[model samples]
Target: MRRDELEGAVREALSHQVAVARPLSADPAGQAIRRAKRIRRRRTGAGLALAAVATVLVSTGMAQLGGDPGRQGKPVVVIGDPNPSGRPIPSATVTAAAPTSETPVDVLAGATLIGVSGGRLELPGVGPAERAHLLPSGGWLVVGAPTTAGRSLWVAQHDGLVQVLLAGAGSIVVAPDGRQVAWRDGTGLLVAGVVGTQLIGPVRTPVPGKAEPVRFIGDNVLVRLDPDGPGHTLWRPGVGELTAGSDRSTLNVYGALPDGRLVGQVSTDDPAKTCLAVLDPKRDLKPVLTGCGPELSPDGAGAVSGDGRWLLVNGWVGKTSGSLLVDLRRLGQDLTAVPAGPPVSGEVAWRTESEATYVDGAGKLVQVNVDQVRTGKVAEPVSVPGVRPGDRPVLVTG
Candidate 1:
């Protein structure tokens, strides 16, 4: 046979054999395509998972380092129960007889004072109080001499509960919010709050002397004073100390305003006269009111109204002097005398912008209306019993 004819016959015979073979459902081309698609999907899923992990890691790093690390994860640490002894005190409710100028007053029964309306309550602890401050939350921060050897500082709640914060505390001051407290243990200044207690310093640092907490400059920062010197130190929890105020003569800081203005008495060169001054650390220390004598109160501390609009001065006028109410807005104005039958001793607290409450010499709680005194009119004094002559009364509002 011829070569071309034989090649054609072979090709035809091969085509016939391919058609007669068994058919396969799994085609090589289709299998290759599905395998490639599966590989592509796996790569895509892995890339997305890696991206998500990276995002989480970046966010966690920012939160750990960018903000205040000390306060980030810190929990509130409760020191003790406000009321240790489970016995509840009687709640007193006082209602006004009629609309009168007399401010509602209450006397301290033990360490608790229940107001006429029952809304104002102050539990200053059960023990005899050496020093006490009315908290903004209608509670009391009290320093008591519970034992013969040591002093106790406590935060007493309005619900007849008391929590002893420090046992051997010396000098202590509560913050404006009533949430934080700072006290002195020998030479060390310690601060405590819901977060916990932190020691600021011995204040003496390189030397040996005493230090005390003056007042809270801000919510988180406080001003500390060294009795031996005239300068003041600013203390923050995480941050170290910073110097505040000038190195002038030592000024006793009593109260502080929200704007960081300090209200206190400044010692003068003349021993006969001292002056009440409002100091701004950013400015020069100048006296706002001069020619002030000794304080009538035992602690020699004055009271500043909650609004920071008025100041109650307890100056000595022989032995019959009463506390003077001065308008903070009008610093040059004369002080209005709080009317009492006899000389008023102890501290006076502002019940309202125009009203003040104080304990008189006869151990009576007297409420004085400043507007009436300014107009030469005397509102009948509302006398409250149970408050002793030396009992320091502080006015509180709900």
Candidate 2:
């Protein structure tokens, strides 16, 4: 055969091989491409759906963790002005008062004299005392039994007039700014302001196992231990239940700062061993103060200064139950303890950021400078009349 005939035969063979290797039908090729695209689309959709579900789950978990779901990732709104005009006036300067009488004032009596300045004595209204608190704005919150079956809650004004705020109340708590008040009656939690009182709660509320006290967390928000047990529930009125935290330890939260920091005690199985800790409720339950001992009162009863810089703690010093001033800035890292004189039966009042008032061991109302306390110097106890020996005084200042 000729060269041209051989080449023609080879070309025909190559064409036949190419045809055999090619796809059998255009329909099959189009179908394969379409099927690959559908698989890619399905995979993409599935991934997006999984991400969305995960986001929802995360949000739900955060809400259960005591975060305000509506305000998540946002700043909280704090009510009331920290500083107003006409504050820190000389007439309001309680530390300047001097005790004059050793006469025992029966605080349990309907009316009791709280303090004396110059020659004048400050006497608040009288009643069967249930509980008393000092308002941050400068006054007294006196709750007592007006009748055998009912209760009376009054705010003793700066002018010596007692304002009847509530009747048939069981518990009361003043707001951080002292502009509002909260009380528990037969119905539930009732908040009162210049506007008026409104009930916020389960009408037929179950009785708390212990005296469940109402505490203000924000201007319009408050927290109470779940009457059922150790956990806590936050209430924001119109906002409904905002956040909640389960009790992971035996720490009892006494008070919370405006920023959501908690001041409480961490109690061990042994009653004698307890420590006061400042905790961040929003974070894991670890305390900012690791050192726990007798320095912190077992009752965990302490007061934070309005500036949030100082903490006045009531605890036993040796055999005597006394009060100590702690600087919050150095908490957990260093212990800056300031002696608040001898222990009194009642609460200590802060007259200024650096000065506080308490009843001395002799039953005399005494005022001391916290800075002097830090220097290991005990200031002379200025005597105030009307407060008797063994009488517990609830100190309040603006």
Candidate 3:
């Protein structure tokens, strides 16, 4: 099957569809618009393999709804009762995980590229950066501070050379391994591999009207369509296929583990009732575990430790600000929520396997240890050398 023919078939399958917007109140990403009518289109199984390849050709239309290897090929787990517990789990006795060999990445102060450990990586041409991500190659991907003209992404080489990657780019996210990046552009979602200071093999794939890249699980980039909605699509760059998103309608994917399991909120039949579920993306988004509670919702900012053992999320516990620390090793069964000061920023960066740092309401960096969280203790907030009260820091970890 040729690329053009595959794309043409996809167009024919989608021609009858008309998109209508509806509002969803329980959207995890906050406000969101839902599709009122969906045209159920299907294609022959034989063409499924080719559909994945056609996605890389850079089309302006949606990918074919054929068999996505990432979703269709994996076995789905059937649980007799999805949620055995009818109520929210406020706390649990956590089992400690074996130490891992994963190396932790350093925290870089906002735009300035100042490392928390020490020293600064000066980006020559790039203006004050609002966001900085550590690349696997020991470089940095920074988003220039926004102005009346909008923001852009710039790459600073390990040797201190700087160059702009994309202009008017937002929702920019680097893969967990720091090899690939995906961001929203005027046309749609664009993804590319990073090698040193240059982007290799950039591919533009069409997505919904409003979308944001959530995180990467291996080569597949999870994207949330509808901007404010829970709707998501897993863009598989390795196979060049953009999946129809999770088949589960109520599941709102937030953070992902290194092994490709997704940690997110699952809404029940009742909108007010929601719980955390760990989903295996390869297994058709099957729920490996569920029923943590609404308090564990990431509320947009969530981070998984380098070893994929701990998941730290910022959210509300009752009326107070708090963070949920879940041990992924036990499939989210062992977890606890700790009261947090009003957050200076939503992001949380892990300093060690058991310790994570976040800016509190006082604009001071506060460290939270897993063991202390279990006993309801929080460390005193300390100030970072270069980060000022008004600065919002962006944290990345391997």
Which candidate gets the maximum lDDT versus the true structure? Answer: 3
Clashing pairs in 3: 111-129
Task: Give candidate 2's TM-score.
Answer: 0.57
Off by over 4 Å in 1: 1-107, 118-125, 131-141, 145-148, 156-161, 194-208, 220-234, 242-247, 254-259, 283-299, 316-320, 332-347, 377-383, 386-398
Candidate with better lDDT, 2 vs 3: 3
Give the better candidate number (2 or 3) by TM-score. 3
lDDT at 353 for candidate 3? 73
- The reply for model 3, stretches above 4 Å from the true place, is 1-107, 124-130, 144-150, 238-243, 246-254, 328-336, 340-346, 388-390
* Alpha-carbon deviation at 309 in model 1, angstroms: 3.4
Residue pairs with colliding backbones in model 1 are 82-161, 82-162, 83-162, 94-116
User: Candidate 2 regions off by >4 Å?
Assistant: 1-125, 128-141, 145-151, 155-163, 195-211, 220-232, 241-244, 248-260, 269-271, 283-289, 334-338, 360-363, 379-382, 386-394
**What lDDT score goes with residue 150 in model 1?**
51
